[model samples]
Target chain A: MPQSMQPGDAKAAEIKAVSIGKTFGAFHALKNLSLDIGRGEFLTLLGPSGSGKTTFLMILAGFTAPTTGRLMMDGKDITDVPAEDRSYGMVFQGYALFPHLTVEQNIAFPLKVRGHSSADVKRKVAEIVERVGLTGHEKKLPAKLSGGQQQRVALARALVFEPSVLLLDEPFSALDKNLREMMQQEVKRLHQETGTTFVFVTHDQSEALALSSRVAIFNHGELLQVGKPQDVYERPSNRFVAEFLGEINLLPLDTVELNGETAAGKFEDRTIVLNKSITLAGKKAVAAVRPEHMFISASPQTSDCNAITCRVEGATYFGASTKYHLRTRSGTSLAVSMPTASTSPIAPQSDVWVSWPVHQGFLLPDGG
Target chain B: MIGKSITSRKILLLAPLLLFLGLAYVVPFLGVVRWSFTMPEVGLGQYRALMTDPLVQSVFIRTLRICLIVTAAVLVTAYAIAYVWVRGSSVQRMLAEFCILVPFWISVLTRAFGWLAMLSNRGLINTWLQSAGIISEPLALARNELGVIIGMTHFLIPFAVFPIASAMRSIDERVLLAARGMGASRTRIFWTVFVPLTYGGLIGAGLIVFVFALGFFVTPAILGGGRSVMVAELVYLRIFQSPDWGLGAAISVVLVLFIGALLALMRRFIKPAHLIG
Candidate 1:
């Protein structure tokens, strides 16, 4: 990838990872992954367990060093800098507030490490106490605080130092659903109020969508994609991104040939043609269409370039929407999601026509 | 009915320990207490003699002082080893455990005798020093407070290690990591997080090791020789050599009362379960 020419492209304060890789014995925990985050952008690293998100975050925070390559904060190499000297704020998975220290002391710890005077630490700690909505908790020890209050204190401790970037490792995985959503908004509000670069890690895609400006999807120690939340979710680059981000109907093609302006593929018992470029010379491919994009009707026409004859396998009704599982004669299962209305096209055992625009389906390279 | 059954079950499990303590501990201990008051064909006769006998009273006082020193030394040394295991890498932790358990497998008499050979004036250590051309003459190694302290510390390191190490292990790793991430140095983390959390173990180990060191027979007897006369050896001499069972029982009674006082003080200051765990 070519580097962007703009030097201070608002991402100037962001952490830059260069050829970073970490391995434990023979197992490669992280590959040669590089990313340049935009400054003050809420970027969430989304992946399942062991996808190297936490490893990358730890390397960025200077707690753990990368096996190979380097890191730069604010345009200077800080790969070998110790965790204390790097001055990066971090909220760990378990909130990790000191049980021995009161809320005020916990919040003032990073400042104290920075050699702040008692008067200044007290003033800043009080300010942060208000900032995290933990006003009366200053005198209470961490053990006395509720889970949500402990989380707030941890956040206050990180933000009090006002570091260049804040790294949060699954900060909300411990909270219940309602509190998780509330804290998500609270974090976003804090970010907006401070304009501090926030790098977060989570396995939940909904969380990434709800809070992040850009979500980096990772799998098996490799970065699958990184883009705006809607861009990555709606227009995925491959099948894995599509499957991981949300539900999608994956239809395999036996063969795909790109001929001038036209693209065509042969399914099990029939042939399909597309008027758009397929980008494949001669290789096996598949088209991934999101479940909600499939338009189903009672009858189908041969004149329609984007249509398939499918029999309904099952239908499931969510509160506001219904999902229909359609199987073609060749036994290829395709999902069609339609908004519930007065006239519903899908009930159990109904014959349906699955149709969508050619642009709605993407021809993913095989095994993507 | 259910409450009675639960009480019976508890009693069944506790019965063997109660029976063992009854014969081995309480019976002999009560006999000594009874004998302390019945010496010289008069009640409290030998018990009053201890207060009048300067030499014997000094022996008890000296025993307490040396035992306190040994206990303090063992707690500090064992804490160093425990702190290392709590924070150090796997290999360092395992090697420390191996060193501690090695002495535990060997007999206490062998350990005491081993110290005797090491601390002896013309022992292996002085021989090595003379051959190395470091010292012209043999240094004092045996029959002194130095020799007794050295032997007792070696014997008690394992007892100290078990509780302190167990307490250090129970401490959550996240607590230390949180401290480090918050920019506490290695030294600061140990002092602030590890030490306070392991306070219970240190106190418990100190109490147990101190009480055991007070009545210590083999190490001090062999190494102290004539100079360091602990209460246990004095009692042994009175009962076995001089046939003074009354004086022996009186000394035994004093030792038991002193140990009980030490335990009561420890309990008042710190909780035992917290430390031992």
Candidate 2:
């Protein structure tokens, strides 16, 4: 794995995007986005469609130029560099393998184009093929290979030249659920093995969370948040980030009061205590808690937990866990996911206590 | 049973086309075939004469040479046009489509005459060149093999453009981008990734243009001005002027068989789907 990198390439390159923005006529595809991608980091740009995540990745790959901003690699500015000179590897969506070339030829393309010796090209292609687990399938064209095999070929082709940075644009969006998971694991292992700076773009929250060293969330061309998966998931800064990451119950709060390291807010008649400090603005706020963090109980389980009384509306059994749909007394709908094994089969229309630790709930600005 | 019924229904749906081809094409082709061997003496005498005829041999060789030249020129030019048509901006694409399709919709005779007017010694191009002092006299741009090639290449470009453009359009743009992202220069990417991907289109276009050029009659006849006669024109002269229907039918039969063999050979290299595209 270490020999794959050429000498003086042990430390991967870092990227800094400063005040990057892209506009297409009247539309804004990205707006004043600033980010620092550390060396050898696996950063995933997570966003909905048309949310500028792909736009940023393209900017990083030098395929699309930013309308305004400086893109720096290590320390030098590369905003004007063309994609060919960037020395980046990109796994495009649908794999985009060369249909006419066999897997070996496809992987050998970049090396040949770079004027590598024929012997070097053959040796590198063989190495990358073995690394990507495509040993016996070298002679097969992309059409003859299965979808997963085609994906492996694409990956091998992109990484054969040992590019300084690797960018993947939703490379697994076309695969089935099981194959996507398998490829995700494959990509994670490759990222670990190669130690190249990887900038992956995807809308799958779990994919972003499970694979990335850091996740950058985008919405409406705005960089909403960037943090570790746990940091963003457990402490989302806004309602959109909280909801986009996963299903979360946002209970509208009123009369919010801020204190050091904690905030007290009112949820109808119940006073909710959040263990994190939050600044108050003119707009409303919501107490956002993931459904998995809250448990359904017959009565309050602990004095240190915030409890809410709600009537069970429905229950969805999901094999290992059950999701209980509940409505508060003031008619705020909430969902609580509990382990099916420990759940006592609460009936609909029955009042139950939903309790979570004080630190599990966080405050977010409720734009709605 | 259901599959058999579906096959029968499909054949029924194709009945009109089958009837049209049998009457319009197969019947006439069979007449030509019958005349090739059993005309003017009910023997293989015409074919024997054809085998040794120097005029026939020269005409066939010249026709092959012209078809090869025209196919090569048409594929190279149409590949460029098709590339623009597939990957260019909307305005450029519209212009390319207009250039290919407008001449396509015009009559082949009109296009041939158009080329004649442009390429003739005393025509627009020569006159312009002479008036501009680029030449003291008109160059022999028409009334020769060069004139015939120019006319045939222009006429066949539209045919080449469709298959090439369809193949180009179906290529994944991201493949080229991926090549670029992997440190391949634009020219390198074009040669390595873009050109290889369009091999199907190029082969399909080459075959269509070559086969079409083989059977061409009007462009060569008009542009050749009797000096550069092709096999098709020879067949025309044999039947219409000399009234040698046996020889004419034999030539026609050979031309058809050659084209069929060429298509069969090409089919070994390219799939029907690629050709259609």
Best by TM-score: 2
Task: Supply candidate 2's per-residue lDDT for A196.
Answer: 88
* Residue A138 miss distance in model 2 (angstroms): 1.2
Which of the numbered candidates is closest to the native, going by highest lDDT? 2
Segments in model 2 whose C-alpha atoms lie over 4 Å from true places: A1-9, A281-283, B1-20, B118-121, B125-138, B268-277
- Candidate 1 residue A244 C-alpha distance from true site, Å: 1.0
Instruction: Estimate, for each residue in A24-136, the C-alpha lDDT of model 2 and write its tens digit.
Output: 99999999999999998999999999999999999998989999999999999999999989988889998888787899998998898888999999999988888888989
- Give the winner by DockQ: 2
Query: What does the lDDT read for residue B153 in candidate 1?
Result: 87
Q: Which residue pairs in candidate 2 collide? A: none
Candidate 1 Cα outliers beyond 4 Å, as residue runs? A1-12, A253-278, A295-307, A339-346, A355-359, B1-18, B41-57, B84-94, B124-141, B241-244, B257-277
